[model samples]
Target: MENILEKLGIELNAETRLTGDSKFSFNCHSALSCFNTCCSNLDIVLTPYDILRMKNRLGLTSAEFISEYTEPVIQKESKLPFLKLRLGQEGKCRFVAAEGCTVYGDRPAACRYYPLGFGIYKNEEAGDDFYFLIKEEHCKGFGEQREWTVGEWRKNQGIDEYDDKNRVWMEVILNKKLYSPELEPDEKSLKMFFMASYDLDAFREFVFESRFLDVFDIEEERLEIIRSDDSELMLFAHQWLLFALFKKPTMNLKES
Candidate 1:
């Protein structure tokens, strides 16, 4: 998916460009775009909130939604786990409505940003920066009626809060090589990353129906925290990634 985006020239300047001092305006009504034409032809990644909200909107259980709607696939070369939202017959987003987005309030961060998108990159020295830009080919909202600066758009879209929540996962994702460049990941690692990062249904099953709780010790309080905060999950996931890649066993649950 990332490769496709790159091949299509959809660069990931996630933070800097979108959040910077540029100005733009967008409004669906005035823009003469009543429906989602821009949602086609790309693999949109779904966050955990995206899965939950979309499932509830579609009136399906987490398990039911995943099995019926999604497929688990790794991004090429990097072998990173991410969920691709299944598209319709015409390559339209499944949740797109004739009226607008069916799940507007809880739409993914990527969707909320519209024509402007964000990306983050890590330098060899561990420094990270953000970039923003207009998307390719099909986006018509760039010349819409409303107007806003990059900062205004970020504030309006609540991207700062979203970034704050997703930072831990972002850190782990960007720093994969730092933990172990030569780690030969097995099927278990793939499944683990997929469940934890992408598929909410499988993740829920692993947390509730499986012995993940029994084998890896998470305290009641921390478990409660993870239930509420994705940052907490990312922190826990980072620990799991460390164990998975470097083989450093963290057996002392009390230590956390």
Candidate 2:
């Protein structure tokens, strides 16, 4: 998740590097003076699952949510599209209020994992996945007595589900980072990536309304799932990307 950390202007080092068993003391409550301070001036990049959940929670179409509350960014190094949450006036998060986060239950993974950042470093020999602390000077949550392992904190914050849903999307990103330099995506491919990753409604339309099914041999049961389940559709999008971009055998083509 280097893309995420870089977008947030956060750089991890030896001091912040943590394993699953690593322990830290942190807690956030309305009683704290910094209750909602971290909600502002953030560079929260929304994952595909994040957009999926948030749009569903607000009863907004993916296109509407993207248009109204997100700003699309093309990463400089990877040249891949990234969506950042649009802050309201005064740099406050659009979903944050005086009471706290209005959409707390369906909050973005970044917000849910506050004071902790997840990352994966791609080494030539082996990849390294780990978590790290974001010890911002203004965050008093670290001073709290409630200590927990990174694994426990992830469970408590409901990050496991988000991570699981976003796994394939993250793999796509990692593949892009590793190979995009060698092969630059054209405009049409970029548009497909954007739609598949962020605009689920548009992707749904593309799948059902376009010739997508005509070319690919998707099973009937899988098609049924994709027809009604947004999560399943998102996973199908990742598979489509793998087939389209990497020439992976994720799907079979219709025989002539």
Candidate 3:
């Protein structure tokens, strides 16, 4: 989403386009002079899996986490719902402390991808995935001696897992962008999207407490996975969204 980058104050041009093998010098630690600066004044968008991980890490349900720590914002162009991490007083991240991030182990994907921005292009001819350096003027991490290929950075930051988990969600957003004006989702569809994307706890209730299984033919083993594993549930949610929004045959209906 080019608009997302612009909103975050990142300007990308031909010179900044990077492939997986492209090397960059950057390292962030408490020892760095500019450490924790990036955590403040950011419009951090939380993915579904990001919320899942963070909420579980904090022992909070998805609904509670959304209510206490996030603010919902609709993307201006895509008209899609995005849950942004709420900053505290002085415009600093609530999780940021004097030493470093308190929730460092379970930080959001955008925090994990610091100094490197990731995006996908929808062009049929050219390549789709690309990365670019954010090189903020005040970030001294770029001046460090440590160097890494984009792939290495992604691996070191555990970004691959986040990206993998978020792939289907990204596809949905991209599809919405591509079909904008032709496919305008109603208020109910938007609420469904938000629930499936951010409110995992509510989605769980919707799946189990409702007639969802009575209508859809989910296998016993898959149902168990969705019941116990948040990741699997997120995947199921994506499939459900595809079926609900685009009428894709991602799920089969039970026969009467």
Candidate 4:
């Protein structure tokens, strides 16, 4: 997820590239000398999937959770809106504690892939995704006895599901990157993107409670799923953006 990595100040290069078999030593438990240090004074950008899980885990509505815990950011290249975790006093993540992350199970992809940055290199032809290590001076976990290949590390961190759910949102950002240096999103479009991408509950209301159905021809079955399912709705929201932003025809319009 370039969206997550770009903010971490990691760049993709020969030294950073990882094959599935690439291995590294790391162990970050409460016993580390630098325990919970990385969680503070850092830039951790949250993906939409990250918000979906954290908000649901904390039992907060999308808008409520974001308003309370996220700070808005705009990617320089894409001019797109993004949300970073709002660090609390001492510059620590709101969810971070002496015991380590309070929201560990529902942590962001950036947290899940900690000490390793993941990204995709894309062009007009095709794209290649890769991982890179982020060995910071403060981290003693890397000096531990444990070692893992990139694939093993990913599996151990349970990052596959996050990757799967975040794929579409990643595509949206990457798609915009294709037009960078010249990418300037309109205000209304940015609002729409933010609402659809981050504010799921508001987006749900906009779709079912607004005249959205009157304009777009969504099937009844899919409608039922998105009506109550946040995950499905998030997926639907990205698909709608594909149509709204790029005119990708991901959704059909009702014929008069």
2 against 3, candidate with superior lDDT: 3
Model 3 scores a TM of: 0.93
Q: Write the per-residue lDDT of candidate 2 for residues 1-256, one digit (tens) a residue.
A: 6666776576767767788899999988888898899988878889999999999999999999999999988877667898999999999998988899899999999988878877775443555787877877788888899999998999999999999999988877778443645777778888888989998888989988999889888899998999889999999998888878778788899995
lDDT per residue as tens, model 3, 104-151: 999999998988888776554656678888877889988889999999
> How much lDDT does each candidate structure score?
0.63, 0.86, 0.87, 0.87
Q: In candidate 4, residue 215 scores what lDDT? A: 96
Give the clashing pairs for model 4. Answer: none
Highest TM-score against the true fold, candidate:
3
TM-score against truth, every candidate = 0.75, 0.93, 0.93, 0.92
Model 1 lDDT, residue 237, Cα: 63
- Clashes found in each candidate (C-alpha, N, C closer than 3 A): 12, 0, 0, 0
- Regions of model 4 farther than 4 Å from truth: 1-15, 124-127, 176-183
Clashes of 4: 0
- 89-183 in candidate 4: lDDT tens per residue? 98978898788888999999889898887757656354566778888889899899898999998899989999999888777877844366665
TM-score-sorted candidate list, best first: 3, 2, 4, 1
lDDT tens digits by residue: candidate 1, 149-197 = 8778888887776666666556556665633556645777777766666
Q: Score candidate 4 by TM-score against the native.
A: 0.92
> Candidate 3 vs. truth: CA RMSD?
1.9
Model 2 ranges off by over 4 Å: 1-15, 124-127, 176-180
lDDT for 107 (candidate 3)? 93
